[model samples]
Target: VSVQLYANYAIGKDVQAMKAVVGEEALSSEDLLYLEFLDKFERKFVAQGAYD
Candidate 1:
């Protein structure tokens, strides 16, 4: 799920879903590994558009 979400966000697929998930997890979690994964996802990928 995490990887899929990350990929989707990075590639500009399901952005609303990704944003919702990120918001939800970011607001309501203290789990270190989970948070780390979110952080990694945020930093590890960038979505590029047709115009750059």
Candidate 2:
């Protein structure tokens, strides 16, 4: 679920789901953790090369 959300939010560049996960008030602990993991995943893995 975390990876799917990351794929949608980062790879697809769609924030609706991420914003929904984050909510209007603030980010929850789990969401924060998932975001952290997503960041690391992109930094460490997804940026291997460029694509059109």
Error of 2 at 23 (Å): 7.3
Worst 10 residues of 2 by lDDT: 8-17
lDDT of 1 by residue, 4-50 (tens): 87654444433334556675445434343444554566665444455
- TM-scores, all models, native as reference: 0.32, 0.46
lDDT of 1 at 35: 48
Clashes of each: 0, 0
Candidate lDDT scores, in order, read: 0.50, 0.58
Error of 1 at 27 (Å): 12
Question: Per-residue CA lDDT of candidate 2, range 5-52, in tens?
Answer: 656446323333565766634855555666666667667667767552
